[model samples]
Target: MKKLFFLPILFLLFACNGNAQKKSSDKAEEKFEVTKTEQEWKEELTEAEFQVLRKAATERPYSSELNDITEAGVFVCAACGNELYRSEHKFDSGTGWPSFDRAIEGGVAYGSDSKLGYQRNEVHCARCGGHLGHVFDDGPRETTGKRHCINGVAMDFIPDDTK
Candidate 1:
C-alpha cells in the first residue's frame, strides 16, 4: 500500500512539474520588454493614466465613464494607446468597474497577483507593465467565462468612424 501510494504521488509531482515548466516556457515566449521612460510615459499619458497604470492605483467604484458608455469603438491603453478591448466584448457586470467579456488579441497579458493576500489573475498591458485590471472566471456563458475588471482611467475609448 505504501508503494502504491508513493507511485501515485510521484506521478502527480511529475505532472505538476511539467505544468510549471510549460508555463515558464510560455512566459518566456510572450514576455514583453518595456521601452519607455517615466518622463516619456508621463508625456504620453495624462495624470490619471500615471496613477492607475504606473502607480497601480484603483479607481473609485462606479466612477468610470466607460461603465455606461455604449458606443462602437476600441478602448486603448491610456498610457501607451495600445488597443486593449473592443466594443463587442464590453458588458455590464454591475460591478461598478469597466467590465469586458474578452480582450483584444495580444493586447493584454496575464500574471499571478498575490496582493491583499489573495491570488488573482492580474491583467496588464502587453507593451507596458501598466496595471489594467483583474480577471475573474465567473462570466456569462454566452461569452468566455472571463470577466476583465478594469479601471476607467486605464483606458481611452475610441469611437468607431460610423459614430
Candidate 2:
C-alpha cells in the first residue's frame, strides 16, 4: 500500500520535469535564427557529431582530439560556423572535455536541463540551437568561475592567423 501511494507521486514528478524540459527546449529553439530540418542536419553532421549536437548525447570524455589542442584559435560551431569560444579562454578542466571559462558574447544560449534528475545549465549554439554541452560553477575563479564543459564533436577549431 505504501509503495503504491508513492509510485503515483514519483510518476507525476518525473512527468512534470520532462514536460518542463521540453517546453524550455522549445522556447530556446524558437529564438534560434538558423533553423534546419532533421534530415538536413543529419546529412551535414557525422553520426557522432549528430548524436552530440542534435540528440544531446554526450561523447566519451577524453576521447576528443580537441582536448590536447594548445594552439591559439577560435572554436566555432561545427554545425553553423559561428564562433563560440576563443582559445585564450580554454582551460584543462581535467574532466576530459574542453572547458572555457566564458563563451563569446551572443555566441551561445542557456537552457535548463534536468536529464540527471537535477537542474543543469545547458549550453547550445545561439545561432543554430544545437546542443554543445553543459556549464557548471566549477571553473577558474580568476575568470568567470564557469566551466563551460563543451563537447568537441560540436566544435571546429580555426587556427589564429599569425600576422
Candidate 3:
C-alpha cells in the first residue's frame, strides 16, 4: 500500500526532471540572417540591450519607457532593427512589460524556454536571433489571444513619421 503512494510521487518527480526541460542554448545553435560576433554586438548595443538580447536575460519590469508608449509606430529589434510588433497590436497588459497581441509575420521566431523550470514560448528576432521576450496564452481574447511580453531594452520604438 505504501509503495502505491510512492509511485505517484516518483512519477511527478521524474516528470519535472531537468533532463526533460529544453536547453536555452538550443536557440543559440540555430543560425540567423544577421550574425555578428560577440565583440561586434557588444559595441553596437548598450549593456542593458546586450544582456537581454544576446544573453537572454530579463530586464527589470516597468523599467522600460516603451511600456507607456501609446503613439503610432512600429517596434524594432534593438540589435538589428528588425521590425517586430506594430503599434496597432500593442496593448497594456499591466505586467510591467510592453505587451502586444501579435508580431509582424516572419519577423519573430519561437522557441521553447525552460529556464524558469517550466515551459514558456520564447520569442526571438528572426533577423538577428536576438532574444525578444515570451508569449503567453492569456491575452486579449478579442484579438489573437496571445500576449507577446517583450523586454523594452530589446526593442526601439520608431514613431510614424507621417503622423
Best by TM-score: 3
At residue 29, what lDDT does model 1 achieve?
47
lDDT of each: 0.82, 0.90, 0.92
Tens-digit per-residue lDDT, 6-116, candidate 3: 999999988897675546656768889999999999999999999999999999999999998998999999999999999999999999999999999999999978877
Expressed as tens digits, the lDDT of each residue in 1-163 for candidate 1 is 8999899889988888653344321233454566567788788777877888876778999998889889899999887778999988989898999999999999998876555556678788898668888899887788798899999999989999844
Give the lowest summed-lDDT range of ten residues in model 1: 19-28
Model 3 TM-score (2 dp): 0.85
Clashing pairs in 1: none
Please report the candidate that would top lDDT against the real structure: 3
lDDT of 3 at 93: 95
> Which residue ranges in model 3 land beyond 4 Å of their true spot?
1-22
* Candidate 3 RMSD to the real structure: 5.5
Per-candidate RMSD vs. true structure? 6.8, 5.0, 5.5
Residue-pair clash count for candidate 2:
0
Clashes of 1: 0
